[model samples]
Target: MNFKKKLSDILFLDIETIPQKEHWENLSSKEQELFTQKTLYQRKDEITAEDFYERAGIWAEFGKIICISVGFFTGLDENKMFRVKSFFGDDEHKILSDFKDLLESHFSKNQHVLCAHNGKEFDFPFIARRMIIHQIVLPKKLNLFGKKPWEVPHLDTLELWKFGDYKHYTSLKLLTHVLGVPSPKDDIDGSEVAKVYYQENNIERIVTYCEKDTIAVAQILLKMNNEKLLEDKNIIKV
Candidate 1:
């Protein structure tokens, strides 16, 4: 594959999430108890809708969106470069709404690929769910529903690393280390994002973390395409 052409059709994205607050308070006592129980277990498969709703509610209150960072890399000016843009939102609804619009406007019919690290399982679905909640239609090009697993056009860095073993699962940070991408040295792992966002109102910190992850994704893509991975210092802030 021509690296330049492929890069032109790629967009890298990442998001930051926090737990919901007011929604949790609205649940009845039994529902609240279920939520409390599920929180203790942290097992999605064993939970019921009531439990899920309560958890989603808890996430909704403190569940502010810290960032929706994206990178659009394309061939331009006879030079290969990537343009990075990020959307930061303290308001979850508005942030997700804006992200949908941004994606719809940029989406094209040229076989572009939406790239993310572990996006198929998490980030992509989260975005899709938020769009549904906001009554926003996803761009036609991004409709991954019901597609065969192999036929799905969206590329996941983590998925690619499996490399036919199908049993090894590695975090993006580990892949970054193997590929020589500098870790952003972020203090907060994703599990703590909700706590930090809600309890501390630390939106900026989360945004920074999201940006770092986006950069890491871009670097991984560079390695996949056999290109000299550019340092993320060159990434432009959106």
Candidate 2:
């Protein structure tokens, strides 16, 4: 797919999530039992299900999005800008609400699309599940009730890199490095997100991490199209 035509039309995004409850004990006994069963295969006999609970954030039912960072292109070349914005905080409802507002207001057009590294598999469905849980109306972009595979208005950079090889998977950090894009990982990576949010109680750090990933995603897209990557001066944080 030629990304040049749609470069300015995509809302590049990334999200950071944490377990809904701070600790494993915070879950109801029934929830705990379900969690154990849900993770039984992965957890195995090596680790107790409760011990693996920190990773519950990977699942929508047990996780909540703490932050959603988005970036979009604007202006012409030489004056081009990739403006970044974030909807985040303690309240998941407000975050989802505000993000929905963004989709409806500015990115509601037919040409507009949502993007992320592995969004179609994780970010997109996770957002949709949480929105349903919170009773938020699904935005047109996230609502994929009956759309055909090719009809979905979404893009995954990871998929682009796969080149139709389903078994191949590459981390966003690795992709950036190989493509000569600046590394987004100055501090914590995704594995440390839960700790930073829970133990450190530092949401701001997570926001910065998410935003950097957002920028990195856009840069990767430009690289794919053989376009020049944006310089620091060209990135505007909103």
Count backbone clashes in candidate 2. Answer: 0
- Relative to the true structure, candidate 1 reaches a TM of 0.79
Q: Which candidate number has the best TM-score?
A: 2
Q: Which ranges in model 1 have alpha carbons more than 4 Å from their true place?
A: 1-5, 22-64, 76-78
Q: Which stretches of candidate 2 lie over 4 Å from their true place?
A: none
- Writing each residue's lDDT as its tens digit, candidate 2 over 60-115 gives 99999999999999998788899999999999999999999999999999999998
Q: How far is 201's C-alpha from truth in model 1 (Å)?
A: 1.7
Candidate 1 global lDDT: 0.69
TM-scores for all candidates?
Answer: 0.79, 0.97
The lDDT values for all models are 0.69, 0.93
